[model samples]
Target: MLRIKGTIGDWPVDLTVEMDDADWARLAQNLPVNVAAPTAAAGATPVASAPVDQLWLAAQDLLRRSGGTEGPQLMSELEALAGSAGAAKGLLVRLRHSPKVKIEVREGVQVFNWVEE
Candidate 1:
């Protein structure tokens, strides 16, 4: 059994998932066991290695260079950079929440702008 409790925006979420041995086995089959998870020491910033971090930096650079971009166009560029829709969307979500990025709606279209510090 797996329990997930969190908030989506202002809404509360509590979820529970259950799986039998076969289900677990099937799920595990699709996951890579060789890759070790990244870890951070106490009081230190967590680090994500390669492609993930590189992709994130590139995503930020893309926004910075553009000054501001429409939401869908940014997603398309990120998808090309990350080489997968899932990875692209992950970067987009991170950008949306980042302190360095600002979101606004321009003429009914969502835009992402880099916030200079």
Candidate 2:
């Protein structure tokens, strides 16, 4: 028998689990094994960023400068960078769905927030 008494997340808990030698032997079979982590060298250099990734980064930067931006304003900036309304629209769609972006409405206007990395 294994007796455990403790408090978890502000709640007091008391638990008793009974197991024979055979039960303990079977428990080991159900347990998961852990893999060791690979160690990096002491002076590892960071990987360089690809140019394509920079476009999204630049968009986020523009949002940061504005502290959050409306859809039209952001599209305008994207158009300036992409050199075409179609290309800018594609980028806008990508930005809208990106994990780093937060979309909201302010005064009936859709605003996009660039979350910090």
Candidate 3:
């Protein structure tokens, strides 16, 4: 038996299911796997996953647009734009050490602001 409870948007969802041994055995036979390939888009470079160069560019853009943003807020926006949390985290960590990056605290929250040279 499997049960799940959660809310999506405004509605609450509660689900329960009973699966026999045969049901589990059937699912084990073939589980879908995702496979990705790198392919060039127009004149752009081939990218299998989120490219570091583009991620950096987007991070800078966000800082410039918003003046400064909280770490978690920046991360969420990056994930939405780049589709990967790993890529966002990598960008933020590198950005934190860059001399061009400006960090400040406002209302007890750390903020990252881009410093233009």
Candidate 4:
């Protein structure tokens, strides 16, 4: 038996899950979105454009480095990053420290590029 509680958007929810290995496997396969971990915290904030702009820059850089690859894992990671605070509006700006770049089965790879205008 495992209990989990979290919030998505304005909804605060709690869950009590009891399952065996087989059940867990089935659940994992059935609901892949339910089994994602959050990204690490980027303390303070760097001077950057809006969250959307920052995301674009970061994504472009990652894509360039990754050779414009596309896959699932990368997409998921992107979603997580975007969902983080100040991501869409371009406020929260910080680069990944470790791995520098990682591969996502769905997303392929990261591609971010900062621009000056």
Taking the tens digit of each residue's C-alpha lDDT, what string does model 3 give over 33-107? 222322356989655433344445556677788878898898898666655676555556656756677889888
Displacement of the residue 5 alpha carbon in candidate 1, Å: 11
| lDDT tens readout by residue for model 2, 2-107 | 5679999999999987765455435433323222222335898645543334454555566777778899889998778755676566567666756678999999
Over all chains combined, what TM-score does candidate 1 have?
A: 0.59
| Candidate 1: tens digits of C-alpha lDDT, residues 39-59 | 455899866454355456677
The residue ranges of model 3 lying beyond 4 angstroms of the native Cα positions read 1-50
Off by over 4 Å in 4: 1-48, 84-117
1 against 4, candidate with superior TM-score? 1
Question: In candidate 2, where is summed lDDT lowest over 10 consecutive residues?
Answer: 31-40
For model 3, the local distance difference test gives: 0.63
Report residue 36 deviation for candidate 2 (angstroms).
42
Reference-based lDDT, each prediction: 0.72, 0.64, 0.63, 0.42
Candidate 4: C-alpha lDDT? 0.42
User: Can you tell me which runs of candidate 2 are displaced by over 4 Å?
Assistant: 1-50
* Regions of candidate 1 where Cα sits further than 4 Å from its true position: 1-49
lDDT of 1 at 64: 94
How many clashes does each candidate structure show, in the order listed? 0, 0, 0, 34
lDDT of 1: 0.72
Give per-model TM-scores: 0.59, 0.52, 0.52, 0.29
Instruction: Please provide, for model 4 over 30-117, each residue's C-alpha lDDT reduced to its tens digit, 9 standing for 90 to 100.
Output: 3213212323348944563333444445554554555544444345555565564334222111232113333334354444332322
